[model samples]
Target chain A: MRARLLEATVELLVEKGFSGTTTTLVSERAGVSRGAQLHHFPTKNDLVVAAVAHLTERRGEELAERAAELPTGSQRTRAVIQMLGDHFAGPVFTAALELWVAARTDAALLEAVAPLERVLGRETHVMTVELLGADESQPGVRELIQATLDLVRGLGLASTLGDDTRRRRKILDQWALTLDVALDKEKQ
Target chain B: MRARLLEATVELLVEKGFSGTTTTLVSERAGVSRGAQLHHFPTKNDLVVAAVAHLTERRGEELAERAAELPTGSQRTRAVIQMLGDHFAGPVFTAALELWVAARTDAALLEAVAPLERVLGRETHVMTVELLGADESQPGVRELIQATLDLVRGLGLASTLGDDTRRRRKILDQWALTLDVALDKEKQ
Candidate 1:
């Protein structure tokens, strides 16, 4: 029941945004009793914070599974970028976007979401590093990896507005080639 | 009075976000009468959209001025990155972020803002190309410039949440160096 409610919350957040989402709407979507929802989450903040955390964990697992399939090399680099593009274009990003926007004005949401964001950020960075088999100790390599992450994120932001998929793919390919050059230099 | 009201809207959009930004607040902050505010922009959508377009044009001018100061070469590349970092961290980005969030659910605002976003995006890309003296006709050069823009934007999104200044600086510096290598190859 709690999981259903959280799922409903994520759906509402992605579709309606923070301003449009309501407790009654969440209960209706989840098919949970209003009394039960109130008992479980006393406030909207409680419900939203829980929903975001749940979504993050599920998405993290999905990312890990996706990462496990790629073999390390330039191909893995390309795959990782594609995977990130998919992740950013999907429901997870939409839900998170809502939280990020809401958090700007809501202090409690910011407090709840910030640590989760940090965790997710750190985890994603680590996953990227591992997938690329990057040596963080290498002076330029760590920053290059960070740059790739930042670039993908920026592309993801563009995707939120409309389909920038074709342009994004072109950029990702170019970026992958650039990374290959940088990685080759590191080997030398 | 119009300028003041628009400025107030930008300030409220940044601090309070879309939902919190109201005509009453904008009027109070601008020290303009409610009647005058409504006269200029009868609806909140009209007010916010106008403010964003106004802000984008002003910021575009500011970018051009900043670009002119940097000497052409790798130094210009580094400077452009730093300039972009500054732009992303400032009011322009904050105001834009507010509009982006609001536009997700508001079709009317999306219609108003989408063309503006496209224009801004294209202008920024062109500015970066000129700043870097990048040859867009060259095969990989245009894509690299796009990648840089995308990366800076992604970093900007991170900045909205909290201070990532140090990390952003490092990524910018590393990316600058990477671009140098790529540009050098293009010459060969």
Candidate 2:
């Protein structure tokens, strides 16, 4: 019941945004009784914060599992960046974005979401480093990795407005080349 | 009265977000008569969309004015990227972000905002190329500029969570170097 409610909350968040999502709607979508929903999460803030944290953790674990399957050597840099691009452009990121915008103005939500976001961000950074076999000891490498993440995120933002895949693919390929140079890896 | 209402609309948007903002609050904040607000914009969608368009145009003009003052040669790339970072992190961007998220689920809002957003996006892209003195005739240069914009916008999103300035500056500086290499320009 708890898992179903959380999944429903995320789906509603993606469909209706944070402002439009309600506990009532979540309960209805989850097909869980109102009593059970209240018993679990008493407030909208409590439910949403829980749902986002739950979904983000699931997404992160999925990313970790996928990371294990990435190809090594020349193709790895592009593959890693593309994986991130796909991750950010997916539904989980969309749901998180709604909460992020709402959290900007809602102090309580901001407090709840901030630390969780920071931890997720750090995990992503660490994962990118491992997947790329990147040496963060080098100058500008850490910042470069961060920029790559930011670039893909921004691309995800663009994709929200429309289908930006063709252009996005080109941009990602170019960034891969740039990353290869910055990391001093041999070109494919 | 219309200008005051539009200004108030943007201010409320930055403070309260789309779902929280209403015509009543806008009129109240603008000190305009409720009747006058209706005379101008009949619906919440009309008012908010007009406000975003008004503010984005003003912001773009301001960017153009600022672009004239940028230094030439080595400092320009970093300066340009910084200027864009400031633009995306400011209040107007925040107001626009609220609408963008709202528009994702609201078909009426999306239809209204899509074309306007496309126009604004093109203008920003053209301006960035001019400011960077980038030659798009070069294979990857255009995508590189787009990636730069996306990076800063993503950085702006990160800033909504907190003051990410120190890290943002480092990332921008690093991107400046990468862009320099991609553009085949002199190192700063």
Candidate 3:
């Protein structure tokens, strides 16, 4: 029932946004009695927080899978960034964006989101640092990783804004290439 | 009278977004009579369209001003990206984002926003070519500019989502530095 509610919440979030979504809609979408939802989450904020946690956790799994597919150091770094781009085009991101907007003023969502963002930050740092292995503690690796994260975050947000699929693909490819160049610069 | 309402509409957009904003609240905020609002903009869509146009025009002027202030080629390029970042942080972007969410369902807003995006995109491209002293006719320059636009767009959206100020700054610097690197590579 909780899993169903979480799914329903994401569905509604992608469609109606945080402010527009309601417990009634979530209940109807989840096919559960309203009482069941209340029994589990007790509040809408609780449900949204749980959904975000689900998002980042799922991201972690995807990152692991992408990393597993890569045998080379450079390949691992690119895969991790690609995983982020792919996931951003997926469900968790679509819902998280709405909550992020509402979070500008909604203190509850703001407080709930910080830990999740930290998890994402740490996961990305780990992925990038691992790819940099021998140079894990290099002077500018942190800056590079942070830039990539920000760029990916920005790309995800912009991708949702308009119908520019071609442009989106180009952006991703270019960033991947730029990362390659940045890595080469290190070797030089 | 219309100007005041448009100004207030921009403010409400930043605070509440398109879905959250309403005619009555805008009328109330603008200190205009409710009947007067209807006299100016018969429909809410009209008001939104007008506000978007107002924002787009203002942004063009703002960009021109920013470009004029930069005395160096590199600074000029950074200024343009920074302009994009700043533009995304306020009413211009809140309106764009709101339009994006609304566009998911409303074809009208999707149509309404294309030209605005084009204006920004072209401005970015022109600024990039001018700053880099690169040939726009060249395929690689187009790729580089397109990627830079994505980075700026993404950075703006991330910042809007409350990416930390320092972190966002680093991303901006890295973008400029990456552009420089890409240009240096192209020159060779």
Tell me, what's the RMSD of every candidate? 2.0, 1.3, 3.0
lDDT of 1 by residue, A61-135 (tens): 988888788766437777887898788778888888888878978998899889988888888889888777778
List the candidate numbers ranked by lDDT, top first: 2, 1, 3
Give the 10-residue window scoring lowest on summed lDDT in candidate 3 chain B. B179-188
Which 10-residue window in model 3 chain A sums to the lowest lDDT?
A131-140
Off by over 4 Å in 3: A71-78, A131-136, A185-188, B73-76, B185-188
Best-fitting candidate, scored by TM-score: 2
Q: On a 0 to 100 scale, what is the lDDT of residue B76 in model 3?
A: 52
Tell me the TM-score of model 1. 0.96
**Which candidate gets the maximum DockQ versus the true structure?**
2
Candidate 2 wrongly placed segments (more than 4 Å): A186-188, B186-188
Model 3, B1-188: lDDT tens digits are 99899888878877877776799999999999989999999877778778777877787788778767766644655565676667666568777677666665466766766666667668767866775576766545676776666666666666666667677666667677777776663432
State TM-scores per candidate: 0.96, 0.97, 0.88
Docking quality of model 2: it rates as high
> How far is B39's C-alpha from truth in model 3 (Å)?
2.8
> Candidate 1, clashing residue pairs?
none
